[model samples]
Target chain A: MADTNETVLDMEVIGALRALEADGAPGLFAEIVELFLTDTPPRMKGLEAASDAGDMPGVEAAAHSLKSSCGNLGATVLVDLFKQIEMLGREHAPEEIPSLVSKSNEEFVRVQSALLNTK
Target chain B: MRIQDGNDPNSVGEGMDRHLARYHELKDSGEMPGLSLPEPGNRVPASSAADGKLRDEIIVQLCEGVADERRVQRFREAWTKTVEIVSANRSGICERFPYDEFWSHSLACGLAAHALSKQLGRGNAEEAFLCGFFYRVGALALSCAFPFEYAELMELRSLSELDELKSVERDLFGMDHVETSHAILVDLRMPDLLCATIGELAGQADGGRSELAYLVLNAEKIAGVCLLDESRGDEEWSAIMEMRRELGLERAEFAELGDAVVRKWWEYGDILKIHTRAVTTFLELDDTGITERSLLGLSKINAMSEYGSPLTVLIVDDDPTARVILKQQLVKVGYRVLTANDGADALSCALQHSPDVVIADWMMPEMDGLDLCRALRRYEAGRLLFFVLLTGRGEDEGIIEAFEAGVDDFFVKPTHQDVLIARMTAAKRVLNLRRQIEEDHRQLKQQLCRMAELAREAKDAAVTDSLTLLPNRRYATRRLSEEWSYSERTGLPVSIVMIDVDRFKMVNDTHGHDVGDVVLQRVAEVLREATRSGEVVCRFGGEEFIVICRATTREDVLLCAERLRSAVERFVTEGLAVSEKITVSAGVATRDETTGNVDALVRAADQAVYKAKELGRNQVCA
Candidate 1:
């Protein structure tokens, strides 16, 4: 489970999140996970729709939003993929973002399951 | 120290460094003036202006180093633009921008820069003036654009040193005034070379800036020192000395420069109608920091407001997640937290709730944290809000900007709970200090009112008889003299009725002093009640009373005396051991040709009382 967690969500990011919790706090890590879970799907849909329509600015905005949320959750692979898409969108590289968006979606599913299991 | 602490916040720390630094610089060159600086009063007076032409000549003098007419014209245009911006925005920016202080410091900078340019012979005086005048234009722009934030920044800057202020501004506003000034100068169509040099020089520490930038920076420092209190910190003194030595300014030349800047500052103050406090000379900068420090060093005694009610914190951020995170952490640490989504909402919330501390995000959609802070600072109640800015930007300049925007504390994004708690602890200390100050003011006001009330009471007590609740002998004599003078002036008859209790000593001996006291009190009540308007009644002495009647005839005065005698004779004394009815002897005297003065009038009345006693005790005598 530990190895799986490391593969899905970066352990260092998890450690940092855990550190945010106080002595008797309900837990910042859990709250952040919930925020990531609820927030990411719409952003993922937005990125896919924008990429399909070849709207680079739209893709960039959606990707930018997802990157920060994924970064907080230690979903390193998704963060990396979304970062690529965001850069591509910024640079107006229309052809490359669609593949990256699918990759982000795939990695996000793994991250979601892994985060839930930890909880 | 008192002067420093009580002075303008911008002037609190570095205000006296130039003077003190000049002292050290001179000492280093073995050319120290006497330990005391020249008196500030020795400077040239502000000359009366011939209005438009003299102003133009002063402008010419400022730009003396500029030889080209076209370039001079361009500089004049720029000067006009500066004036336009100030005049146009004066009303809108009245609450946020400190217009007097901004101009005072700017004009001083222009003067100082021009002086330095002339003294060092390195840069054109016109360029120096432009650089000095426009250097902090970004500060004005920022204050106008984001008033609350800029106000907060200034507030923070006042309490902090230059270094700390730089970081705080960066944290709060994403850029410090140097960058803001650079941007503004570029936008204003200032020459690129000049703008670039100023931008380069404004941020560098101690070394590695161009000579022009160096001159302008030192000029700015001089301007700050001139306008602010004379509080010397060793750090500031060393920095100023380093700059002085680098520029090779002799102590005498520096003193002259100070005098020149102050003289021009006063002259500009008059022409511009910007109020100016007298700028102190390097030697004349008063060092009252110790007294100020003592005043500020109040013990950290927690007030009832602190212990009784939980410290309320307003957390303002556009991101709900960020707000939740901060709120949960603060609430866990025993704070009563309120949340606002953006700066505008946060401000209204702050104004309504008056939170002890405000934790706001630097970046919001419409009005950011600094804007909210500035807005909050504009209102009297919001000035004390311990604003803590949360920012994603981690730059030092950004931090300084945040402080300048009036943020008490700055935290980078993804703040840890422990960090938040620690920041809150610091916030509480600041809040306590504010509360302590307010409590001190309230107590001082109460004490003043009490003292005033006591003074009024003391004034009254000097003339009032405590035993009879009437004017005493002293008051009677003074009143009689006043009446006598009035009668003398108006040729009106003024009469006096002197009444004594009949056999008062016998009454005291028979019934004891307590019963005699009751008799005297009852007789006083009758006398007080019987007198009409224009009749001044008083307890003259033991068992004796006097009444001064204005515009009354001798016959009427005799009738009034008899009325008092008969009233006392008829009244029964109640609640006393003795069953004796209280009575009084009566005498009347009116001011006539025979009456010499007020004293003689009283003597004639006393003689009539003796005559009344000889004839019969209860009858009236005249």
Candidate 2:
């Protein structure tokens, strides 16, 4: 795989790394990635349950919060996937949401592995 | 004194009793009882012709007195009031007032008075007012004196001839009211000119009269005939027509003046606590004689009507309320309106709609009006949008900035609505005129653009060497002039370098112009590649080329020139298929401030080139 620097990532990813270094924890990216990896699954499960129950507001609230967190972490692809989920949840289209959540999970695993491997 | 009727027969005494009885009988009959029993102080009986003469004299004297500066000034206020009143009631009077005799007479009297005053150089404008007021005083007095007979006469004659039958007053009252009034005026010692005019007006004497007085008298006569005709007889109508021509009154103008006079009478009567209908009738009777006054009044009415028309406006402001207020006020004034919100919107709207003019606000959120104004200048939208920047900021800097940004005009915010409407109206007119001017400008710009493109094409064709695609001699001169100016401004040394193909004609003669052309192209490529972007390199016609370098020192210019010469030599020998090896002689000259002319700079470079050629044509010289 190409390095993150060579890939077209959101500009905020650099800003987040710089912020972590400025906060006196230059090697804290792995811990933050682990936190995201551990926290996002339960949120996704909650969204799925709320959407299955036809609770559109619940689905929206969960999806929106998760999406913003992913954006903050500079996980642009995940953020885009979460945004689509939020839109779908708000629009009450729960039937087409499983595949999107699966894709987000897969991308999250990749980002998590990459973070764990960082020197 | 007592009288015994058949119903109340009481006995009375001799001669004194007989006179008393006669006076009582006259009083019982509602006649002028005092005529039979005169007042104790009266030494003279009221003769009809004398009184008529006196009334005429009094009227003339009154008119003359008003001509005096003091009296005229006093009357001017009254005249203005009369005009205001008449204007206010114009529609009402036109609807209600009698169209025939009375209205015509009043208009005639007003005109006659104006004419007389003008002829006499009298400053009293109120003469028209007064003439309209009292022209029919004689007729009114007669009506009062013989009420029963006048009522009978009014009934017997048609509505048009009320004034004409006044001659019958002599038969009924033993003296007409015109004579009676004249006598009273003479008794009061009025001026003789006045007395003579009254006599002329009353037909009491064949005296010399002013044309205005005659016009008034004729108007009155025509007015009376018009009143008497129940069906408004054609004969009376013809007489009125003749009177109109005689007074030089156009028919429409006569009607308008007549209506104005009636309106004035109605208004004045209301003010003075008199009967409005009665007063109107009286004035209308007088207007019949002076047809020109009616014509004058009509022209004035037409003028007033014209002034009542609405203006057109364009409102430009970011604030909705400002636009609404401006639009409302302008609409009230009968103005057509257009509105734009901000500078960019205003500009686009102005360009698209081509409004009569633009009223723009300065402090807009996006694209301030000044920027929009500057942009508008590039368009031939006629008179450059006639931009008016309405600003709350009154700083000199802001104002200066607006002007610098190409605002044609400026207005402070919270301008009076009326003033704004007026200004916008004026702006609209100017912009409309500019529309034509802008159309002409568009045509001219189109023409100029076409010419510029053609010139550019021609220049490209003439000044580019075909094979190398480098500028020829014509372009070299142009580049030199520009470079010379740039050098002067920056005080930086500019250098011109000239290079020539050594034996270039021989190459062309041996290999033909085609290969020679190829060689030239290759040399140009090398020179272009070696030179900085800021430098100008051109084929200086045939096998010679020139380069202009900005901000270059003398040594730098020489080095660059030498490098180019070496590159051309190396490329031709190593890379090109040539029968003979090629080399170039170069010359470089830096601009000298002491001799700042481009021609001089070129000459120096040319001399250097000559020197290089003298030194065996393969090296650079400066």
Candidate 3:
């Protein structure tokens, strides 16, 4: 469980985010964490729907959006899974995108708890 | 400083000649570093036979970079040759010409004119550039023509007005720089419009000046501010502010133009191989108290947001978090921020606020960023809006497509605060320049329309009677000539019905000129209303009128004259107690073979009027 947690979340990226706090007001990081928690679910759902319908462009766009949101909060493992899904969609490999999309959802669950703890 | 002769080293003192000779000896022996060129007296002709084309090409390149092609071509040949002539005799010209100050000022002036012309969108950028460069050529020509006298005259420039300086120049050198510049331009066969515009700068007041002339004037003032000493009288900071207000620029934007002028001046100096001194920027001198504000979070925002009406930015994203974060960043940097959930929402928000900039995410549900950009561009106000697209993909093909849809800039998300702030600053600058230009264009168009209306009024006043509101004698004569020529061409006899108010002298003596004027006005109205469209009735002079009848014979004119006489008799003059009834004596004359010309016909009518007066008052005669 500790090894999986180490791979899933990047503490150094969270420290950099903390440095962006204006005179230690404690709003930017919480705001970004809240945004990531709200923004990723709908995008992950759209990525699954696009994979089911074989909509390559839609899958690419949704995965790309999710990847950017996750990367902002230092969800590196989930970001990597979504990046692979985005590439599969871009390259028209619909067969491989669904597996990666499911794996991304599992990793996103862990990133959400880690972000909630950090907040 | 007074002008110096470069060739005469002994002019400075006795020991300088020996040092100069020794320096030249070492220079010729290649022991000392020097430019390898012919001595002052040993140079080629003004044409500079060798490397002339290369020199012209260099000048052409420099000019092309500074001004537009069409305007540059108008004076390109003459301008290049003048530069060559000056360069060939540079030492001699430098002896008389205040080379350093004049060169720097002229270069700055030309650059300012080019930038100003483009900014105003007047389509005369090149003409402005040429005008600015040659504006002070008269001083150079004067110096060359009368070096000693012109040098002494230039000393009075700071102390005297333009007219006073001209008078002094006339006393000393027999002519001033304005006249000399005019003569030089005419000799160069410059465009008549350019010559006339630059020649009219003799008067300093801006009233009754052409737009091109004003452009040159302002360009010179801008150059004065840029290159001259800070304490110079004509180039004071207040003068720049006044011109800025006249140009319809906010304080911040005017400082931007000043910075551009200085930057371009240095670039032009490099191209022309002239030395440029360090310039204190207009922005630096303009301490608007914002710079003095403490560099804290909220205080810095307060100081910056107080500058000249804060610009608004509309942030659009399907994601709520992206929208909120971006809005917060923009608001932190003093931007008035509007938020929207999607592209459709952004369009409505933009319409309500008319935001200066729109930043929207590309991948939206119904109307994406590209579609939103296209939609905004369809509106008249939206066409000027600065649109930035936020995309996750920074693909080249996508950027090209986005640009085709009218996106001004692009930002990738998740956005960095620093990058967003930088983009906002750029947006503010571009928007300010565009708005200033638009205001200037609108004002210039209105001024042109007003000037056209005033000119029409002046023309009408010149040929119209002041009191009677009828055509004056000058218009009558011109109409008579036209009618006479028409009669000769078509074999039609034209008739003239001359009218004179009866007992008009008594009316003036009894009342006053005011009542007499009213009497004449009443009589003019009678003649005007009674005459047909084919006849032209004019107040020939005081209490006298003439009706020109085209295609009318003598018989017809007699009846027309009788009709006018009866109409005047019937007109009861109101508001005049002394002269209640106004009547006129009418005389008719027709063009025939006996009356060979217009003057003879007019004379025949005059005699006929006298005959009517002698026979009986208020009667018609032929």
Candidate 4:
């Protein structure tokens, strides 16, 4: 038995892949994971720099990008976390951003490993 | 404020400027509120260099309020650039549009209104900005619609008596600029709240002045003092004082706000290529509220009237005298009218105003009305701008060219008043039909988008199993033949695996169907994970399943079958209703030269599955 927090497969992505039977081709699930892994780092840095500079517009742009991408990849927990950061970037205090960003980074590592394990 | 028909025509502006000076004499003496608006003279185009393209930053700056979070953004973007280009270039207007004065004044008034809107805490800053900038739009539409008579009215600027311009407009065109503008904006589908607010300036609102119009009036005068001739300072100061008394705006706070707007304009004025006579320091001010041009609260958008809005008519003729008579008749019978001197002016006015019908002289200078009709057709497909040429040439060949060039209907020159009016009335039906068609098309497109979404959902539902959300037996059955045909073409053996939940009925009996459902779902998940990309798995009714393996020989099929059997055995049933281990039996078969058909191959897999079940559960058979 696997712990809920451990790198276990998400049935949703596997189910989506099951529907698409393109023989001898790399599945959509792998490509989506690869895309998310590549897309998250620059965005995380952008959120950090924008928060540090007190640039609400930049923070909002970066947060919005991260939120949608995470939502599309079925990173629901990370998506919710990113949505909080995005709302903050739109209004209210930036002081709370660092903790959220770190939490997002930690959770994404689990998501990344779990997605890779499915391969 | 009303003006008595004094001998001096200049008294219209002169009387208002002198209203406070002669307060006792004029306060109780004046009859009504007249058109005391400042008429900005023609621009002396900048000597250095002039360009055509209106840069994006100007809209960002000028429409700062209106553009910020308003849903009317597409209109805002287009309107801002239209305003900027009309203000920036002198030649463009002299050629196309008839009225070229006071646009800079309009922008200044908009800026001042935006500044004041912020000060007053009025939530609709962008709307105020747009309303202020475009306050004088009615004046332009009227003057352009009847150039000759309007030019004569311009000479009457000294007569401080044309209190609403409604009377002078009534005498001449039978309708004033305010009425003309209301119809124009309504046709443009402008926010009704905005239209209602501007209606205050027309002195036609049921109540006195709307709060928005009061702020615009004060801000406009303040801007006039700062940007216009220094001689207008006394009038500006008096106007500001009166607005302060009326609106409760204090001088010091307003001075700060007005100065801020003037200073802000300097920072980006040159970049936007805006033409301005130095607006040095803001005059001592008194006002409230700011109207950000593009950013306004979305709440208060008047339920736009799509169908019943009045139609706009553009009158184009080289003879300004003839245009005046034509405009008077159109305005008399209640039509929102715009007029131009030639084809150039007519085309520009038609595009900017988007009038429902264009009435022009057939033989005018620089692109006759027929040629103008052809040029209009190039703008957007499917004849939105209706063209009617007034031609003396009723010859067969000329009429053919006019019709070929897309003239809707024609009025021969020196047309009878009743006859032309009747023609206009008939044209109204066609125009209304076009509007209805446009409304229908817009609704149909939205319906198509919804239907496409429903179709996507339906397609998803059709292919997936309800319980586990895996492909069902129907999907697997379809994929089997597809794989078999592909295998035949490539000479690659196709394999099948018949899977069954070993003693599924016993699991259900022991733990109930809830636990049975969980067991079946768990087994499906494990099988899905074990299978590679080229394999298809389906629930073949209760407890039974199938997998189609493409381009795979018997050996690979056997390995895949053993993997699925082991995976189902290892599936975790902890915390589930099932107490016993969950497992599935798999039987593998492959297509070969000896296999007669896909049915024979499937029968072989069925026999293999029964053998696996007979060989005691939780084992693979090949």
Best by DockQ: 3
Q: State the fnat of candidate 1 relative to the true structure.
A: 0.07
| Tens-digit per-residue lDDT, B327-381, candidate 3 | 6566544455678888767765575457888988887888888988987785555
Superposed by TM-score, candidate 4 places the C-alpha of residue B594 at a distance from the truth, in angstroms, of: 98
Tell me candidate 1's interface RMSD: 2.9
- Model 4's CAPRI class is incorrect
Against the reference, the lDDT scores of all candidates come to 0.68, 0.57, 0.69, 0.62
Q: Mark the 10 consecutive residues where model 2 chain B has the least summed lDDT.
A: B297-306
Question: Candidate 2: which stretches are off by over 4 Å?
Answer: A1-119, B1-67, B70-132, B158-160, B184-193, B204-208, B218-238, B249-622
The numbered model that scores best in TM-score is 3
Interface RMSD of each: 2.9, 25.4, 3.1, 32.0
What local lDDT score does residue B388 receive in model 3, on the 0 to 100 scale? 95
Per model, kept true contacts as a fraction are 0.07, 0.00, 0.34, 0.00
Can you give the TM-score per candidate against the true fold? 0.32, 0.26, 0.37, 0.30
lDDT by residue (tens digit), candidate 2, B1-622: 1222422214434422332343334445664222122223443322356443543343443455354675644454333333332333232222222323433444445544554344434434344334433454344434444556666666665333445666565456544545444443333333444444554555534576665465455545433432232333345545655766666766555554444444433333323222323211112223344322221222222211122322223576555534544454444333445677766555555554455456676656566767777766645442345778765423245777788877767765545544665566556566556667877988999898678769978766456665687777888898788878887888888898988889889877755554576678888888888777768899887788899888899988988898788888777665444547888999999988577598888888889989999999999998
Tens digits of per-residue lDDT for model 1 on B403-515?
78677888766676556666666677878888799889989998986777599677764576756778899889889888888999999999999998888898777545555
Ranking by lDDT: 3, 1, 4, 2
**Candidate 1 lDDT, A17-109, residue by residue in tens:** 565564234457688778778877876897899889989888887776566556556677887788788889999988877777778878888
lDDT digits (tens) for residues B5-35 of candidate 4: 4424264344222222222233245411121
